[model samples]
Target: MKLSPSVTIEQSETGLEFIKVASEFCDATIFLQGAQITEFTPTGKKPLLWVSQQEDYQEGKGVRGGIPICWPWFGVSQHEGWPAHGVARTGLWRAEQVKEEENSIYISLSLPMNQIDEKYWPHKTKLLVEFILSTSLEVRLTTTNLDSETLNFTQALHTYFPTPAIEETKVDGLQGSKYIEFGEGPFEQHDLVSFARETDMVYTQAQDTQRIITPDGIIEVSRENSRSCVLWNPWIDKSKRLSNFADDEYHVMLCLEAANVLEDSVELAPGDKHTLATSLRWV
Candidate 1:
């Protein structure tokens, strides 16, 4: 573990390595495993990210909350018996750089192809997740195709936002997008989204910005170089089936992920690169 004035490389009680940031504007924590950010609290405001209180933080298992990097793939595997949400979330990433600016602190972590299992994704690629922590949290996930041929994949910055009560929270700016739930209808969204039941919807033709109205305040979620967003809330029954998640805990968290899934999946030629990014702030 390494310690600095603004950043620290530390290990969790469960022996997982993470980078901790305490800047002039906010405090954040990013786990080297999966290159995931589990906490982001801007000064004088509620936390911008949410993590499960029951999260085990164990190796080879993803933490229940914050921003889980769903890379190479998102959701269930097309292949039989493969891990859902790909292997990047549980694989240990290498921290490459940390820099402090006047107002924000930046950290970069990378996952190399050598660390991945060829059976699941055989492409030789490089994955990097960069964090810019300040009054707002900004994340950028970049993928570089290092192989000779073209590479394609789906991905998401699966971000969980905290709400005083899930039932009372509403998301704005998806009013005109088209969505599909549980692989069902490409329903059109005409109103602000609110959770009623086990909500899982993939939205397309979405705007670049959305707002989450929570009891605490309005959280502004903005995206770049992305066209798909996912809204999910496991209301009652499905919550019981999730690992490291409490059945009743679903009442306090909701996910509005910025993603490139389904029709928005990326295809990169040799030596090509793509970047997917999202930013969050309390407005």
Candidate 2:
């Protein structure tokens, strides 16, 4: 496959192929399998994304962090023994196009419906994930339904960000949004969200822009075509049970995902399309 300047096809130690972007504006890595972006850092800023040190880059497995494209569905499946957070995160994607501009590199990847298990995703749909790497990281996932029947589903750009201290981290701009945590309480957010124990909150009617305040700096996160998002930190006990994640690693990472979940879930008419997008920049 031909790549443009500042882009190269690289393979993980486990032989998983990925696209590496090293331009003046940023440096990033995106695995073809799952189309997962595991790294992104602007020229003089610390990393804007985070990946687990225990994450073993291998085929048929999603990387622990960066942005995992949870598609067809989000969270647990109603079917027995299905993978949580959907199959798109573990499926391979084909690079459809790559374009480089003055300060950005855009790489578009597509997952063929045939590559997905028929039992999991029977609909005829086109899934494309596009990465715009520059001074900041921009991700856009577009879903186009080619089937004759209408489609309904939930999805998210499950993004993990890094902080020097999780205790000092607070997320602002969700003050009035509604959230359901541990599958309970459509509680209204009253103040800046702070982390102490394990935090897994699904928020709806969230504002498009949020500020993640960390000791190092603030990260400005903006969403497009999404009113719902997920905020997570495994804390202690659950961190020990998670795969591809070290127990102590939870102290420095948090996920603020842009999603279409629950009441914010997507419904597409035949031949319709929808795109979920998010942007992150260190401030």
Candidate 3:
């Protein structure tokens, strides 16, 4: 992997390799495992991304924060004993390109299709993730079908963000959309989303833009080629059972994932391609 002047190769505490990116606009840390980005902070602002302090950073393990890529499938898998959220998160990805631009730095990586287990992902396809780091952060996940038959899959850029206090953070722009929670009714959102209990809501026909209003300020989140979004906060009971997570951590962090899920899952025909993208900035 060729490195640009703004990007350097670094290794985790557990010896896993990653890319350390520094530019005039922002700084970031991207791991080769899962090609996951664990950090992104603009020139002189608080971080726009968050991670668990207890994350092990172990080999072939998923980190507990930032933008973890969920591909091929989302949530529980239909196949018995198959890993939930598919295999892309822990699979090692190869750095394909890096270029420093005047405004934003571009970094690209690809997962080797042969590395995937046939039982889990048998279809012929190509997977790539590209990152644009600047004052704002952008991540794009692309899937290209090479099989003769059509294929369908669900995915999400599972982004974790920080808040001074969960009670003080609310999300706007999802109002009027239909959603379901814990297999419950397809309720419609009538107001800006606020956290009061264990929240796990999957929204379809969601607006492309949403604003996370925190005590500090508002962070604008937008998606491309996505109308499905998952808003999750483990609140109290489930937090104790989570790994690489502190029990009380729920008070400071939440996930507003940009996803292709439920009725919005992707369907690609032979020789077709699709891209799911998410971008964020303080507004």
Segments of candidate 3 deviating more than 4 angstroms: none
Q: Once superposed on the true structure, which residue ranges of model 1 sit more than 4 Å away at CA?
A: none
- What lDDT would each prediction earn against the true structure? 0.91, 0.92, 0.93
TM-score of each predicted structure versus truth: 0.98, 0.98, 0.98
Question: What is the per-residue lDDT of model 3 for residues 1-283, given as tens digits with 9 covering 90 to 100?
Answer: 3388789998877999999998888999999999999999999888999898889899978899999999999988988988878899989999999989899999999999899999899999999999999999999999999999999999999999999899989999999999999999799999999998999999988899999999988999999998799999999999999999999999999999999997888999999999999999999
lDDT of 2 by residue, 197-246 (tens): 99999998889999999999999999999979999999999999999999
TM-score of model 1 relative to the true fold?
A: 0.98
Angstrom error of the Cα, residue 211, model 2: value is 0.6
Q: Give the TM-score of candidate 3.
A: 0.98
The collision pairs in model 2 are: none
lDDT of 1 by residue, 119-213 (tens): 98888888888998889989999999889999989999999999989888999999989999998989999999888899999999999999999
